[model samples]
Target: MSKMIFINLPVTDLDASTRFYKALGASRNPQFSNENAACMMLCDTIGVMILTHGYYRTFTSRTIADARATSQMLLALTVEARADVDRLVGAGVTAGGRADPNPPQDHGFMWSRSVEDPDGHVWEIFWMDPAAAAGDTTGVDA
Candidate 1:
């Protein structure tokens, strides 16, 4: 069987977070959702578990850091094209998320945009042409 990845994130408001993710094209997995937690299916192999701050604390003894003030990690997802990256970012922003404070990246072969969800979770949406990214200097500057 293929390995599946589950990312757990603490959210200040479960309902709002659920809406934000749905706007980005993820669907809620009823099998794993509840009053205190929601399972957002990003795809067949990846799932994001959004837990209420109180419920999240049950898993760890440490205090939850305010994501707005500090970034613990950047969650990245690769899409088929640059447009797809932009689309997700647009959806996120429209749903009350904020774009990354940093400038977008464009390396000829790869393009990326970042956005912060309502709870301040950072997500990087990117796209890369495999051939161009593999050192194929055809039509690209070295």
Candidate 2:
């Protein structure tokens, strides 16, 4: 299958967003991250295009949601394992992000936690055991 790639988000402050994602271990794509937009590299194949509010608004007609007080999108990023979910959240906290108090979710096969960046973008870190997810297994990592 073709690899899934790219997500575009709106940021109020490009510089701040650049610094924020950097703290989460994502590098700014110099080629794209600039005065108008910034490309945050999530992986070799995956990236998030962050555009300034004005630039982002040009593509949509609806009013922009206040990222900190509201949410326009929910982004779930898969992690290597359960520990990775926590690790990412912890890293977010140290970098000025906030972990949602009531957002932990656990099902027999799927587990997730989330944190919000200063810009109020929600990042859901999740882990899914395919065998369990498919109902073929009962054992969960945790």
TM-score of every candidate: 0.94, 0.81
Instruction: Give one digit per residue, the lDDT tens place, for model 2 in 36-90.
Output: 9988887788788888889999999888788777767788888877778888888
Error of 2 at 65 (Å): 1.3
In candidate 2 the C-alpha lDDT for residue 1 amounts to 59
Winning candidate number (TM-score): 1
On lDDT, the candidate that comes out on top is 1
Model 1 RMSD in angstroms: 1.2
Off by over 4 Å in 1: none
RMSD of 2: 2.7
In model 2, pairs of residues that clash are 33-38
Residue 60 C-alpha lDDT in model 1: 100
Cα distance off (Å), candidate 2, residue 139: 3.1
Q: How does candidate 1 score on lDDT?
A: 0.90
Mind giving the per-residue lDDT tens digits that candidate 1 earns over 18-100?
A: 99999888899999999999999999989999999999999999989888899789899898888998898999998889986
Clashing pairs in 1: none
lDDT of each: 0.90, 0.80
